[model samples]
Target: MESAARNISFKEKANKALGIVPEDAIISKSYLFVSFIALLVGGVLGLLQGLNRAGLLELPLWFNYYQVLTAHGILLILVFTAFFTIGYFYAVLSHTLDGLLPKVRKMAWIGFGLKIFGFVLAVIPIIMNEASVMFTFYPPLAAHPVFYIGLVFIVVGVWMCAFGSFIQVANWRKRNKGEHVPILSYFATGVFVLLFFGSVPVAIEVFMIIPWALGWVETINVMLSRTLFWAFGHTLVNIWYLTAISAWYVVVPKVIGGRRFSDTLTRLVIIMLVVLNIPGGFHHQIVDPGITESVKFLHVFMSLAIGFPSLMTAYAMFSVFEKTAKKKGGKGVFAWFKKLPWGDVRFLAPMIAMIAFIPGGAGGIAQSTNQLNQVAHNTMWVVGHFHLTLGTTAVLTFFGISYWLVPFISKRVLTPAINKLGVIQTIFWTVGMIFMAGAMHWVGLLGSPRRTSYTTYSDHATALGWDPYLFFLAIGGTLLMIGIIIQVYAVIHLMFFAPKGETEFPIAEVEENATKTPYWTERWGVIIVIMLLVIAMGYVIPLVEMIVNAPPGSPPYSPW
Candidate 1:
């Protein structure tokens, strides 16, 4: 009892010293502020696209559908996710591992500036209609040279932050010799490691595209660029997944008054994710021509391999929920579910996110399969899959995190009113995604194409048949926009206007009886090397084959 008291006292002191360090808080706040602003802009643009797709709104010439589409994709997918992940994890680093190092903080600020500037530069071309290549920025559809240059800067900025995270983690290890990294910081480490390494292929792709975009090069290797992009593209998707799951594994347990499921299992999941992630990108290209059958199968296997960790995560989370509920004197399997805090926005939003992933992940696996992909690739089904996985599964969880995170950093508390508003926001987002994504999936199966403006193909029967589903898609987008408004408002209020008080940076403790995690999990160097080997195994042969037998390069075509 004395020892326990002493430990508690030390923690109190440590938290007092570390509580919402002004400088560290500012870094995360700035990132989050930008994140929400991007969401606002992108959400509006999404509404425009949805309306256009439904044939409800014909956009002006200056702001056409493709331009809106491109901007919407980049803002939400690239800007919002990137900034929020960095911001949230930086806070994770600060809270879990004491305050951020001064140098690390400086690096983060510099990275922030670079990313913002880069985004501005990229946006300019899109506004001028000089770049509407969409987020994938696929090579035969090149944008202005300046756009690619801007992406280079963004990539560099992300690298700066990634390295800063590395420095912070390393510094902590040096000071605390034989300790495991705090669970949240360990998650940050995995995310940043991915940010740095995953961006490499995209960086190379952009460099190759710049000269081609500038007309200095006559032609670009379309297939090669695509292969490289997906290498980064799918990994970027997983980066967001890893971030959301961090909250699930660490924050959710604490919010519900339970210990984390298992430290070793958790750590192992991170390791498995890092090692197996990059090659899974190939599954995105399974339907693309030029890849050999054997290589395609390899990628399919790798992609499915990535899902295994998610299943493990699912099992762990369910176990935690059941155990916690039973501890609350709830009896029976189904009845315990009723005991959870459904009214708490922090839990409600993320719990819904977890539930949404069931169908989202199922769709993803279906898309990964060769035959199924042939039907869905480049269709509205693909669009629905993206939104379901990223928009609802990842973005909703981010929303949940913001409820407490913004307050925690801003030295405020999440008020009851805002929490209730958040629950409403969660409902709006959930219903919106189902309407939009479900319609997209159904219409896509009915043979409606994506990446095009609404038209009846001169009033053709099949095209006219898609109208009802597209209208539902519009309704979903409208609801989602409403959700975005409430969410952004909640964030703003939590950041600046809520009653001044301390909000806990919730990181759950490991269960008392859990087995010790192997120290080998700490060998990030070995893990990264293995990640590299897996990536090379998945890429080298197929990449070599693509390069050696490549078709003649294609000149840039700005269809917009």
Candidate 2:
């Protein structure tokens, strides 16, 4: 038995030394390839929408503005982020946990197929201009029944991948009993847990909508649907965030020649985020009328509670930076920042992402306030907020990950030229987002509305005032298009044409003499139960009110 154990241990070490197993690499590569494809297509759609909104481009009636808008939101916010998160985490699981089990691998491929098939089904309607209800797809603004059906498949696909991660992690723990899961893998576990639970509300929402959309039900509860959608919507936003920060904690440290922050602190942040995340959705509905003022206030507190974990993250990251710089013999407070790598694309991109979030997070808190939300709700300000958070913070981090992750999975090296191109791409993206998002916020404060096509309102003075800012939006979109082209080229070259060599999956280690993390942190089952309880506490009352004391339902409307 001891010899058997020894041999197993040897095999696991060999697997690590040899890098990602070939079979597992294919799964990550496939997901990544599809994700970047979505980015390319979605990025194009984004530029078109930007131009149209700026009154610079007039789309043909065959493919109108709303269709483009809906598709853009779905492709980037839903498809691009979802695919990249799954792909990245799968690679993390394989690298840190030795390798994926065969069944889990099979499930991943199955999930990929389902998602692709579903995306195709959903896109057909968008192309036909039958599903212009936007990504939110809330009731009364119904899409084709097929669109909701497609969403069901996408949700199931996500669940499959989530469950596969669970199986992979559970198997690893059983094999290495009493040992803490590697930090990167631990982050992956939290991400997949959020993916599974976060998507549940959306799934339920979609199922309810399909019948109303098909006319089996004459009318639908609009507020209830919006409530359900936000439950998933807000969580989905954080799922991308958690994916971004997993790298912030694990990969960024190694790229910068630093050790990770305290292991116990890191795990605590993850637990706090998972437990407190779902309830924060209520803030999205603060402006909507169905829920009571006291309920919204309670939810405002819940939303603020989520920010605590983000603050913890901010603290942990800077500490790593200062400590690492001091070890390298840096002087003074701010001088340590200069000692850090500013040229490496892997570092440069995520660093900018973190910087963008300072304002992005602040904007989110402002929007959660009752009075402040009433000001920005359904305005260009809201659009600018997400653009900053998701477009800059989350998307740029994904770009940073791709520089290393693409080469690592492809068994190739990131060439100096490609890295240079990535740096330029990051610069373009940052400047573009700043101009566009900044203009959006300014115009929104000037009372500009969102979700409308270009209009001068018969050249009214207030409407004319927005044109200057809208022109800035066009300029930013043009720059971002250039960024996308360069980024896509870099990804393709790295995947297929870059010189063959080994690339290590860069996961940072804890500092020497670090304290051991408690085993209780590994009790995800209990953590999940607590998360569910908190979710129930947050949603039960409001959801009950929305349903039981409900207003008259509205029938489907197809304004388009």
Candidate 3:
């Protein structure tokens, strides 16, 4: 078998120097630009929210902060993360295959352009205060028809990227004949499949509810809409994290100079992710009024089931790290920890992310418990939990992957000084989130709400306790924003100003003794279908009940 790296030659260097960027580089740059812009927009919104909560910002009582919050959450969580995940998958494929897909490449660029244009159109009426409907697009509270129409275009654009990826993987398999798909590629393909089906609800909601809200349809059921929305929303975060995990699987082994502890186990873990991701969406509905107690309990149990794969991952990766560290002349259980390259940003960022996962997993377990769910639902505690998991753990993994890939993609060496700054930035982000989450959790125990724009003093003691917690959260938010800015600066510098170089890192190789498996089992289509069935079993019953007994004038559940 020929190595893919053999295809690249010195001649390609001249092409790159002539300002003709490589396909992977272009994709990476595009996603980076989008993510940077998203960070700015989301940050401004966050700052405003914090200020409003603290009574530092005053506006008309009629002004809807809910709309602003919804936009910020959707842009950061849905749009930006999706763009990054797609771009990262493309980068990995280009690197591993040592080639580009021309049709896919063109499609991706066009999709990105259209999505950006759609976002601009959607935001216009929002900024003008003419569209104050919250992000969920629940019926009866209408925005401009353009907002919903534009959202549909954005979703269509994302689908185009997903389809392009599916085609590229299919082509790769056909061309390679008997070669086994690399485990990382296999995992990425699985995630794309999940993204494909998981987004259907949001697409439908945008098409149906937006028009309905705009009076195109006579009436829509609000409850049914939220149910469907969560069906999609629940799995969306999992999809994003799955991509992050794929990056971690590829990069962690390289950073630690260790083969995966068990190749079979790693594959099993991925299987579990596909199986467990969507069923757990029910866990999100625990606090809803109409849902039955039995169904919520079933989801709570399934949520616990999702933890199995996480534990498996932790065991496999840590064992590999332990073995590698000992082989390199370190000794003892904890001593190997000391030998790790703490100064290397690539190593540190992921290490911190993994550490944050300890808290994330613990919080998840808390939320999954029926009794605990009652205590935490709709409280600042929920806010703290997600930020720890998604913001600290998942976002940091993205940053680490970008650090490793930027130089390879850009054909330039990022400044070591800037890279060091990035490491510090990640530290601040992790620490700040920890403090903020802790404070929020404490306050939530006293019944502080999650979605409120401000906290009012109904009693002196409650007000005093809430005020201090809000103050701490404000400080944490400021620190996180600063860290985010530094990261943006580092990414921009790597793209436009980093010194060009000819050095090539070898295509990462899996050790010969690494795990091997049958081709049929690895096919992503089979895995994804099984996953969908599991999700359906959990969701189908509730959906039926929602349809049969939905209250009049209430929105139908729309899980996107």
Residue-by-residue lDDT tens digits, candidate 2, 398-498 = 99999999999998999888889999999999999999999888899888899888999999999999999999998999999999999989998899999
Candidate numbers sorted by lDDT from highest down = 1, 2, 3
Please report the TM-score between candidate 1 and the true structure. Answer: 0.98
Kindly indicate the candidate among 1 and 3 with the higher lDDT.
1
Clash pairs detected, candidate 1: none
In model 2, which runs have C-alpha deviations exceeding 4 angstroms? 1-17
Best prediction by lDDT: 1
How do the predictions measure up, each by TM-score?
0.98, 0.97, 0.91
Question: In candidate 3, what are the lDDT values of residues 1-560, reduced to their tens digit?
Answer: 24544433443454344332476578867877787678767877776776666656754544457766767776778666877787777776665554558987887887788788888888877776656665555565667777777777777787887787787788888887777666677777767777777778767766767757566666676666777677677777788678767756667767767655555666677778778877677677778767898888777778888888888778766876787788788898698887777777777887788888887889888887878889989898888888888887888888877775666677777568977888798888877786677777777877888878775766568766687888778777778888788887787787777888642322234666665666666566677778878878887878788779877764333221
Give the per-residue lDDT of model 1 (tens digit) for 1-560.
Answer: 49755965697677865587899999999999999999999999999999999999999999999999999999999999999999999998887777899999999999999998899999999999999999999889988888988999899999999999999999999987988898889999999999999999999999999988888999988999999999999999999999999999999999999989899999999999999999888988887889989889878889999999999999999999999999998789689999899999999999999999999999999998889999998889999998999999999999999999999999888889999999999999999999999999999988899999888999999999999999999999999999999999999989888999888888788888778888999999999999999999999998898899989999999987
Measured by C-alpha RMSD in angstroms, how accurate is candidate 2? 2.2
lDDT of model 3 at position 397: 85
Regions more than 4 Å wrong, model 3: 1-21, 59-64, 133-135, 139-142, 458-460, 502-508, 555-560
At residue 169, what lDDT does model 1 achieve?
Answer: 96
Compared with the true structure, the alpha-carbon lDDT of candidate 3 equals 0.73
